[model samples]
Target: MPSVRRLRPVWAETPGTVPPPPGAPAPAAVAVQPGLDELGTPLADVTFVVVDLETTGGRAGTDAITEIGAVKVRGGEVLGEFQTLVDPGGPVPPFIQVLTGITTSMLVGAPRIEEVLPSFLEFARGAVLVAHNAPFDVGFLRAAAARCERAWPGFQVVDTVRLARRVVLRDEAPNHKLSTLAALFRAEVAPNHRALSDARATVDVLHALLGRLAPLGVTHLEDLADAADPVPSDVRRRSTLADGLPDAPGVYLFRGPREEVLYVGTSTTSLRKRVRSYFTSAEKRGRMTEMVRLAVRVDPVVCATPLEARVRELRLIAEHAPRYNRRSRAPERMPWVRLTDEAYPRLSVVRDVRSGTAHIGPFASQASAQLAVEALHETFAVRRCTRRLPLLPAAGAHACVLAELGRCGAPCTGGQDHADYGTVADQVRAAMAGDPGEVVAAHAARIRTLVAQERFEEAATVRDRLLAFARGAARTQRHAPLARCAELVAARRTDDGGWELVLVRHGRLAGTVRVDRRTDPRPVVATLRATGEHVAAPTAPATAAHPEETDLVLAWLEQPGVRLVEISGEWASPVRSAQSVRDAVAAVAVDLLLPRPPLLDDVPPARPGAGAPSAPAGPDVPAQGARRTA
Candidate 1:
């Protein structure tokens, strides 16, 4: 048995320390035992064959692996290294060629996957595999294994991606892309996007992240694999979604055996990757424990835009009224906080769901929204209990004691004047209008008025407020584009094994498949299902995306044999198509909004005390709910 030991640093083992053997091993040679400590726990006695693959596209199921890089390490030392570019029986795309600088001319005489697969298997045997987003690379390898009619050389996988997210990152970073991590770690760059280069980068990033997190008890391969946030209740022993998902924006419904929705979600990106995330993320694991256990099949409705996704999600929740979706119902039923038009202004609670109504919340919990409303009232003095104001004290009625507490202006008892309080109430009303442009304009006008009156000190304060409002408006607008651009495409194996979908956007594709007695089926099937179904329906705005829409996609599809043909040339009759597209898109967007619940539709009510115990129309409900929900 190999002795477990600590790994020496990479710098300590310079290049040229080991020479290539006279001949490569035979196809069926015994496989190397992989080192489980590639993530840098104490060096284990086991050996590791660090591996990397350069592929034609991002989707493992659809993309072919063109290059492979593998290195054997044991006792903290490099034992051997293997690298090659396999000639997939297809033309390489130009952009992929550019990204990897692996031209068709260069691979003219390379070995096929059949020839390379066995060597890789031999090199990787017995070793725990390590890679950045190991699942992605491994998915490709598994696909290759299927092609060759062999089991994926049985081994555990350690993902640098998972490690980075769980223990490496300090806070919620914007992204966790391998390139981004590579840059941060200052990994060697022989040729980025190439199999060997990326493998080296993966190793470097793994080292850095492990060095930072080893103290957190991540000492072994199993420890890291189990380190997932939303740990899957069902381990994918056989059926992986690699070939089962369509790479598009769409709503996905997780169902129990009897067709009950365990959860509803959307992915504008890769469905397989997104689904894998739920099973792999550490934090998301806690939130999805129950759903994963109950999930038997996943259903999806594809969309053209993210806005459409959200619309569909809400519609589905309302239509199906799934037991999993409880969060969204409260907000739908609760009353909204409205600012009254009456003089001396009072806040009222309205239950009707209509536009043009300035409201705060329809929170799930009335008490929470009410508390928020109270807190806001304390800060801004918005009205709480609405009534006919400025009335003479009723017979035997003293005064609402809250007036003295500064909660109410005491208009009922004539304790305070109206004009003085009216100005403050007006500002609060303007703020509650919930129109970004209106709020910004209102604040800007206030600033200008203060300046004209020579109240420089006050003018400065108002100016700051205006700036803050403008910043907020800008942020909202920024998110608007993202929300609009976001869309999903959902495809899953049907009862009889067929697939269906609605729309897709941004050229991303995703889908899922069942595991059964089949030959290497991922590559051909995933792409075939995606092509036959809906192509991404880019909205008008998507045509003008930054970096030039067509060019970017074309660049991505530039490898040999990859071609992009204009499918629909700005449809002559686009009004209906656009609407259809938008609706489809919104369905997916709504799906994205479907709360990522352990169950589903977990958005609580926005109004406090709106559900029970009190008159539903109490003005306190909306204000309270909004604050609590917010």
Candidate 2:
């Protein structure tokens, strides 16, 4: 090291310097007035206060402030400086002392943060705050101000880190750190891990960044915040592609040179903003950046509301299988768990849902469908042996292990009567139709037993299977009423004081139309009916609806202000719907998974005189997977 220079407070004897006495009132000049210029105000006219802080650690709450340094400048001229040593009321850790050269001894007799904060606030008044990494310094200041019962001045903040990332080329500087940038720009003062030196160094870096921004048309203070975002020249040149986009809810498609859709996306607020964002450096995904480079044109489809936009996006992705879009491209390939119609009904996973069959799922995957099936089998005495049993079993057909273990009724061997088997089959159908309380309760009881036995892994496995069954049952039951309905109209108010109307047919969204405020809605309704695509009623067992689109529609329907505008058929979730059973299962499952004390507390105590709650009776259906026992 050359020679260590003892540092003095930079604010001492500087122009407009005023050091108030300890515990004195805050200065009158400390009050910051809002800026006169709007967002488009020129950068050169805006005053900036470059600030830095040396602290004991990174956390604002736990860390003690050692020093604060700031430089106020306007039009590239220094207006004043603020620098002070703060008695943090705690000892500085040795590690911090080594890193910052600010020992605990140096803080002795220094003014507490409360004594120095008011003067610094006065010096930085009426100025935009700039810092290398703003959040750190700004966070500490705000925390200290709060502790001192002083209102934060609420200065507009700018971070040099963000600006440097936008403007400085990687080859020009190895990194955006203050020391590196100070040397790169040959600043007058070199940063030495001290607050004042580092802050002065930052002021020069700020000026250098401003110089680089001027050529990029970043004259306005507001534009400077995003000046560092690197928009490729080719993308910038193609900005006209978004000119025709509407400032309304819609989906947009980016097309490659060969007219192939490169990406599909939706925006609820503004198609223009969302589409335009792809051309700017704000889109940091590497794959997206490449996609933009390849894109030659933009396409927009306006929708009545965000729900329609989302639905359209899903449909478009499914139709095109766009290379850039990630989700809902294989909706047709999703699997469903169907209960085959037979004298001996069996659960099977099928790709296509046929008309008129009891089924549950448009499960995310084949494995998830299997899990749901497993959950149903584990709880109900549904036949698990995969034998195709005739109306009357063959005389010599042998019983399987599932039947031997009493997990299934030995229907294959004629050990059970047909009438008894039919009853079990009916019970299974009822469970799938939404009366899942018995299955859920059984699983809950199993989970509790497993936990008591300390078989936690087994308990977790049972819990997962139960959750899968509950979720699948809930989805099936909730959509069943809508699926049965021939047609319905629902309306929700839009943010712009307009009405968004949705046409639903057999649980599928037929069409959506928006009516503007002060506009007659009769014509819009007529137009919607004339142009809307008709969604045919799904054949029984209905295939699982597209979950994303279905969720969007369901959420809109459930919104507080949503109203049923019209209905051509009945649509209602039954009072004893599977959704309620799913909720009950979830609550019980959660209670079982918690630590022992709560788990024990939540379990109902077995009474000497009371029996377990009897399963509620519903339409008698055959027990799924269960055969008549010998």
Alpha-carbon lDDT, every model:
0.52, 0.74
Best by lDDT: 2
How well does candidate 2 match the true structure in TM-score terms? 0.65
> Tens digit of lDDT per residue, candidate 1, span 1-630?
333334455333322345346796644545757555444433344566778888888886677889999767764556777899899778889998988888877888899999999999888878878887777788999998898898775787777777687754555445788888877777665437778777766766766775665566545555555664334436442135334877777677777889887777767655666666555433344436556666777776777544345545655665666666654533235544455665566655555433333344433345434543443353455455666665344455445667667777665556555776677676664454322334434444554576567676765444333333222222222222222333322322324433322222333332233233343334434454466434444332122122112222222222222112112221111111111222222332244332121211221111222211121212211111211001
TM-score of each: 0.40, 0.65
Give the clash count for each candidate.
99, 22
User: Residue 137 of candidate 2: its Cα lDDT?
Assistant: 92
Residue 218 error for model 1, in Å? 3.9
